[model samples]
Target: MILFLGTKSGKEETKLLAGISCPYCKQTNTLSAITSPTYFHLFWISLFKVSTNHFVECSHCKRAYYKNEFTPEMRQALGID
Candidate 1:
């Protein structure tokens, strides 16, 4: 028998914070908060979360930006201090 264990990474849209103008698409009310999780998996099942990251994505263009890249207003809307 063989055991399979490894790490897996995935992104999830956590919430629809206040919509804002998107820099890439030049659109309004398109940015949202997304959460990315890297985790340890066993037999295709996520066992434990190893780390987490936050991002801002443009719904219109599907562009993603790291938390640090988010503007002050965006971070404030997301309740990130």
Candidate 2:
């Protein structure tokens, strides 16, 4: 008998937080929030979610920032407490 099991990680864009100037690119309306989920898989099929993480990105510069790194305004924009 043989068994196949492993973990898979993926990222998805959750929603558009707001139109704001990016600190890195200094561009407006380019920052957005993304959700990254890590999960367990069996036979290439997703079984259960292991963990999830949130991030902010600048569409202009393609820079990514973790949720905890978000500023007060940014957090509020995303409706995150």
Candidate 3:
């Protein structure tokens, strides 16, 4: 028998960034911060978290920004350190 083992993405939590504006949309208070975790899985069951990802998106333009792409202002606003 063969067992399946891999990593899978977990639930994402979203928070509205009240003071942040979307770079693409240029709309204030339209940015939302999304956070999710990647888990190691065995036989389709999640074992442990491997990593966490952070992203920012615009509610109006639907633009997404990755962690690495986040600006200092964005990082400070999101409390990401």
Candidate 4:
């Protein structure tokens, strides 16, 4: 996954833009890494052009997100700004 660091509300941390999180578990408090050629290729294809995609993970819930689900602070992290 493509990783970036950004500051949110005056706090800095790392996050994934196209990472996957387990949806079944929401409070496991564990985070996992995911990477695949198709996923990476899609992200690059969209990023290289004028498209923006955001992927988020919930360590506590293992849930993932895309697009509108991303926070404004995360936009800066993934170079969306």
Best by TM-score: 3
Instruction: Report lDDT per candidate.
Output: 0.82, 0.81, 0.91, 0.43
Arranged by TM-score, best first: 3, 2, 1, 4
| TM-score against truth, every candidate | 0.66, 0.71, 0.83, 0.35
What's model 3's overall lDDT? 0.91
- Residue 58 alpha-carbon offset, candidate 3, angstroms: 0.8
Give per-candidate clash totals. Answer: 0, 0, 0, 2
**1-81, model 2: which lDDT tens digit per residue?**
777999999657577756667777788888888887998998889989998888988878899989778877678887779
lDDT of 4 by residue, 2-47 (tens): 7553322221344443433344563332443222212222422322
Deviation in Å, model 3, residue 22 alpha carbon: 1.8
The sequence of per-residue lDDT tens digits that candidate 1 reaches over residues 1-81 is 999999999667577755578777888877878777899999989988998889888888899889778888788887889
- Candidates ranked by lDDT: 3, 1, 2, 4
Candidate 1 regions off by >4 Å?
A: 23-27, 60-63
> What TM-score would candidate 1 get against the native?
0.66
- Scored by lDDT, model 2 comes in at 0.81
Estimate the overall C-alpha local distance difference test score of candidate 4. Answer: 0.43
Model 3, range 7-53, lDDT digits (tens) per residue?
99999999888877777778999888999999999999999999999
Cα error of candidate 3 at position 1, Å: 3.7
Worst 10 residues of 2 by lDDT: 11-20
